[model samples]
Target chain A: MSLELAVLDWFFEPLQFAFMQRSLAVAIMVGIICSVVGSYLMVQRLALLGDAISHSVLPGLAIAFLLGVNIFVGAFIAGVISTVIIGWIHTRSPIKEDAAMGIVFSAFFALGITLITTIQKDNKIDLNHFLFGNILGVTVGDVRDTAIIAALVLMAVFLLYKELLFYSFDPLGAQAGGLPTGLLNAGLMVLIALTVVASMKVVGVILVLSLLIAPGATAYLLVPRLHQVMLLGAAIGVLSSVSGMYLSYYVNLPSGPAIVMVVSALFALSFLFSPRHGVLVGPRRGRPWQKLRTLLPSKGS
Target chain B: MATSPKIIVDHLSVNYRDVQALRNVNLTVRPGKMVGIFGPNGAGKSTLIKAMLGLMPVVTGRVTYGDDTLAHQLDRVAYVPQRSQIDWTFPATVWDVVMMGRVKKTGWFNRFSASSRQLATAALERVGMLEFRDRPIGALSGGQQQRVFLARALAQEAEIFCFDEPFVGVDQKTETVLFNIFRELAQAGKIVMVINHDLGESITNFDQLILLNKELIAAGPRDWVLTRDNMTRAYGGHVGFFGHVA
Candidate 1:
């Protein structure tokens, strides 16, 4: 068989399974929203915050399952609460923000694990699915939920692009210019929480940071502006998700780890080969040897 | 726009953790004059501006502008923080940074209007940064970065302007451009206040001076505020005021 035919067969065979179709749709939606919203995290140096929120959502998900409510809603509330708690701890005490995040996320993660373990004894639910996402098991409803989240997150990012850029770049300047920075900050946190909840079903909590951070960081090496970084990052994320699903289907690999590996691979590629800022392909700076040569007397001298 | 409003900081005090940063800092800054705030390290120079702009919580008195508090009228004020407070390595072009000045005026959920872009372009051109509009902020020289920030403030078109240490790490040309624009702004009946650490020859550019050391030591015309006694009070006798007479 021709290589082209083999490629087409590889791509089309996955559509034959309903699970693959649903998981692909959900993956694409989550991929787009995570990267788009995650650009804010990357530029603001809040990658750790993304990890914190993602982990903190697990307890909310477990509790929501217990209450028979929407896991997404519970996860979002938990994520937001964790951020507030972190802020409160930082402000009320001499503890810095990183320490605050560490304290809050670990406590929430521990509670989530304990709750899940206790509930698993009586229920059909598997803790492993929540810890490591079971993308192959995504339902049509999950796809719909992911789509809605993607639309809302993308729209909020679109509407508030300029304001968010100003706030993130220079918050004090934005505040002094009469931009309600507090409101902007709260709005950003909501967007982040929503993104984290939407992404939970695709990559789970432990690996969501890769989806939220790697794509944007990869794009940053290639782009010069925030909007461009977000745009490129979304493309990279979608490509990674689709290709990762394909890899999982063909190689029988775990879907979440596959997606994360692909995104990380893309980041490594960009880090080495990006045109403007790449380590290998970018303009070479003066090396130590060159500096020494310039410092010492020239051969003519 | 008639008789540009004056800024009155009255009996304002600020406490950071357990330390008192500022105490009863009273001063009146009027339009059409350039005021320089000078003091030694840890004298609450930055805190005074932050408190006045309501960026920090104050324990005592308030800052007002005519009938309204300064915080309420922040739309009319443009404040540039010290360079150290900003992360310059963030992925942003000069154009992007300059356009941020118009973000407030353009309102939320709205695109920047044509006139706003024009103003930003004009400000960039005025600062000789139009050619570098597409350049990332991290790639610029220190002086160029300072110029870009000044352009952003100019694009704000505010009535009251406050700059914290604008001259630090800037080239001579940037300093010249900054002072010229400041003088023009002050001459146009705007209130221009700068927090400067230097008491060198550039001190002559200020029309009035506010000497501070956690409290208001002296405030008046440059000569009066730069007296030897005031310098000694503010700087703990390490500073020798130029033109000071024994």
Candidate 2:
């Protein structure tokens, strides 16, 4: 078989089905949106904020499921509410930001799990589906929801780009400048929550945090400019999603973990070989003198 | 300069958990005055400034700027926090940092109108940092970073400015430059409140002094406030650390 024919066969065979097509579109959109905002989050040292929001959204999702409303709305609402609580706790309490996040995240996630177990004891919903996304099971509604959420996320990022940057870099400075630092910080948390909800369909809850942080951090190590870092991160995110989808399709692996693995691999490659500052390169040639000595002849003198 | 006092603090106090950082601190900064709030370590110097600037949440008593409370007058005042407290590696150019100062003066939504950016650039030029405008803040030396922050505060065009330990970690030459800038601002009729540790230098450079050691020691002209009695009260045992007048 020709190489072109084999490549064509893989795409056409699986993607001809509606669910696969929906999954690909949602994944790609989620990738682009999350990465752009995630770059800012990483730069601001709010990388773990995603994990906090992700876990916090569980109760919201659980309540929404019980009430039969759209789960995305519940997740978005819960994410924002939890973030606000965390911000409040960070200020009123002596605990730092990370500690506050830990307090809220664990408690909320445990509550969500308890609610799920207690509420749906008989023939419970597939927790695996939420924890690890199943591309083969995505519906058209999921794709549409992803597109709307992605657009909203992009708009928010654009609107608050400057203020967000200012707040992220210097909260006290931003506050003194009358930038409404609290509202902007809250806005960031909201943006993060929105990003999390948008990503839930593509990467699922269990692997969402990895995608939010890894690609953006990898881009950060490679690029110095803020805009360039954001652009590169988004590109990396999209590539990871596409390659991960393909790898999962072929290897019969779970799609969500596959995407995270691909993103992790990208980060590893970036760590070892990025032209800007690759770890594997020699000091002179990005290698040890001992290795260089092997290439040179021994001198008797 | 306006006849009204640029800053007023009444019965101000701050408690950092069990320790009281400030106790019943009161102060008044008139326009065109370069006032130095001087004290030894743990002297509540920073707390006084933080309370005035509303940075400390647990501040008690009242702080007013001109006719209104300082909180309401946030736009009319600018604060330059200590350099050591900030994240220098923040992904912002000198230009971006300076530009932030104008955000308050400008319209809502943190929009940078043409005039705002122009003012930012001009502020950088004033600090002799125009050449390094495009450089990231982390790449700049300690003095340059401090100057960038000063330029940011300048861009606010505020009536009152509060600085916390602007001279710490700075070279002697940079320190001189910063003081010169402070003098210029005061001469231009803006209130300059600085938290300083160099008492001898403060006596020479500042027009007024607020000597503090966890409580209000004195607040008046430097000559009257820097007396041996007040110094003894503020510094306590640390008075021996400084040589008396020859």
RMSD of each: 3.5, 3.8
What docking grade applies to model 1? high
Residue-wise lDDT of candidate 2 within B1-246, one digit each (tens)?
445466788888899866788888877888788899888899988878767777666557998886778876677778888898788876667887888787666665556889888888888888888999888787789988888889998888887888888987877767777888899989988888898887554457888888898999989887778677788888775565345222
Q: List per-prediction Cα lDDT, in the order shown.
A: 0.90, 0.80
Question: TM-score of chain A, model 1?
Answer: 0.94
Worst 10 residues of 2 chain A by lDDT: A282-291
* Cα lDDT of model 2 by residue, A108-134, tens digit: 888887877777766456565666666
Candidate 2 runs further than 4 Å off: A1-14, A88-97, A119-124, A275-277, A281-301, B1-5, B200-203, B240-246
DockQ, prediction 1: 0.83
User: After TM-score superposition, what is the CA distance of residue A219 in candidate 2 from its true location, in Å?
Assistant: 1.7
